[model samples]
Every structure is written in structure tokens, then in C-alpha cells.
Target: MLQMLHEKGLRAEHCYAAGIASIGAAFVSWMLSQRMESNGIARADRWGIFIGEWAPTFIALGNGLRTYEK
Candidate 1:
């Protein structure tokens, strides 16, 4: 996937950056949930998991863009 993105002109660096950002977002979401009084631990965990899933999609998009660029 990295190779394909490179071939298309998409940089691995961009994908990596996006992945990092997604991770950060997930972390923030989790943290916010943790602070919520009404939602509790289970809610926080669910939110964290949901946000966590976004990281992969961002990474995949980045990879696809890179491939296309190449």
C-alpha cells in the first residue's frame, strides 16, 4: 500500500501524519468521555473504541491517495 501510494505520487509522510492526527482525535475523545459524569466508564470506552476505528480509515485514505498520485 505504501509502495502503491508512492507510485501514485502520494507521500508516505502524509499518510503517517493523518494516522497520527486520527490517533490524537481518538485520544481526545476518550479523554472527554472519561470526564463525563453521566456517561460513565462504559460510555467512555465505547466512545474511545468508536473514535479509535477512525484511525484506520484515515490511514487507508492516505494510502489510497498516495497510490493514486503515483
Candidate 2:
């Protein structure tokens, strides 16, 4: 999968950027959920957590891609 991704032009920088973006997205999602939904803090927390979970995977992928880059 890493080989294929590299072949297709996937890069570490892209994953790093996405990971960073997801961090902000998590905050945005939480705020939006808090204001736009009537479900309260618990629901907003879940929304933020779900999006925040993506960052680790993206950062890990970036590290793996960095190996390919080297």
C-alpha cells in the first residue's frame, strides 16, 4: 500500500498537512455541533472526538510515507 501510494505521488507532506487540518476541523466540528445541535455538550464532544481521532492515523501515515520518501 505504501509503495502504491508513493507511486501515485502521495507524500509525507500531504498527510502532515491533513493531520494538522483535521485538528482544526475537530474544533470546528465541535463548535458547530454545540451551537447547531440541541443535543448539548456530550454530543459535541463526540463530534470533536471522532474528527480528532483522524489525526493520529494521518500523522502515522505521514511517518510511513517519510520512510518511502527517504
Candidate 3:
């Protein structure tokens, strides 16, 4: 999968950047949900946790791609 992604021109840097971006996005989503929803903190926490989950995947992909780059 990493090899295929590399072949498609996806690089480690891209994944690393995405990981960083996802973190920011998670925070933003949490804040937004907290502010906008009537459902309160639980919903906000869920939103935050859901988006936060993407960071590990991107970071892992970045690591894998870095290996392929070698």
C-alpha cells in the first residue's frame, strides 16, 4: 500500500502534514461542535475524538512512506 501510494506520488511529507492538520481540525471541530450544538459536552467530545483519530493513521503512513523512500 505504501509502495502504491508512493507510485501515485504521495510522499511522507504529505502524510506528516496531514497528521498535523488533522490534529488542528480535530480541535476546531470540537470547539465548533461545543459552541454550535445543543447536545453539549458529550457530543463535542465525540466530535473531537472522532477527528482526532485521523492523526495516528497519517503519522503511521508518513513513517511507512519514509521507509519506502529509503
Candidate 4:
């Protein structure tokens, strides 16, 4: 998908970077939740999962855009 976006002259790099960043954020959220002293661990997990969901869409959009360009 990234390759297709790159070929289509879209800034696939940024899309890829955003996906990576989202995953990082999700990981951090999960870690923080685990380290928390309160009962917010589940909240943190949910937040991480929610944020993690976005990565795939961004990737898909990038891929779709690339395919459309082609």
C-alpha cells in the first residue's frame, strides 16, 4: 500500500510515519496503564486499543489513494 502511494506521488512516508507513531502511542498508553497504581488499567487498555485501531485505516487510505492513482 505504501509502495502504491509512493508511486502515485502522495506523501506515503508521512502516512507510514503516522501509523508508526500511533502504534507507539498505543504501546505507551498500554505501558502506562500497566504501571498505574489505580484501577484505570482497563481504561488505558481501551484507550490503547482505540488508538491502535486508527493505524490500519491510515494505512488503508494510503493504499487506496495509491491504487486510485494507478
Q: How does model 4 score by TM-score?
A: 0.67
lDDT of 4 by residue, 23-47 (tens): 9988988888778837767787887
Q: Alpha-carbon error at 32 in model 2, in Å?
A: 0.8
Superposed model 3: Cα runs more than 4 Å off: none
Question: What are the clash counts of all predictions, listed in order?
Answer: 8, 0, 0, 0
Q: lDDT score, residue 70, model 2? A: 86
Q: lDDT winner among the candidates?
A: 3
lDDT per residue (tens digit) for residues 4-58 in model 2: 9989999999999999999999999999999998978999999999999999999
Model 3 C-alpha lDDT per residue in residues 1-70, reported as the tens digit of each score: 8999999999999999999999999999999999998998999999999999999999999999999899
Ranking by TM-score: 3, 2, 1, 4
TM-scores vs. true structure, each candidate: 0.68, 0.97, 0.97, 0.67
lDDT per model, in order? 0.76, 0.95, 0.98, 0.75
Candidate 4: pairs in clash: none
Candidate with the larger TM-score of 2 and 4: 2
Error of 4 at 7 (Å): 15
Candidate 4 residues lying further than 4 Å off, grouped into runs, are: 1-10, 68-70
> How displaced is residue 3 in candidate 3, in Å?
0.5
- Global Cα lDDT for candidate 4: 0.75
Candidate 3: residue 41 Cα off by (Å) = 0.8
Model 4: weakest 10-residue lDDT segment is: 61-70
Per-residue lDDT for 7 in model 3?
Answer: 97
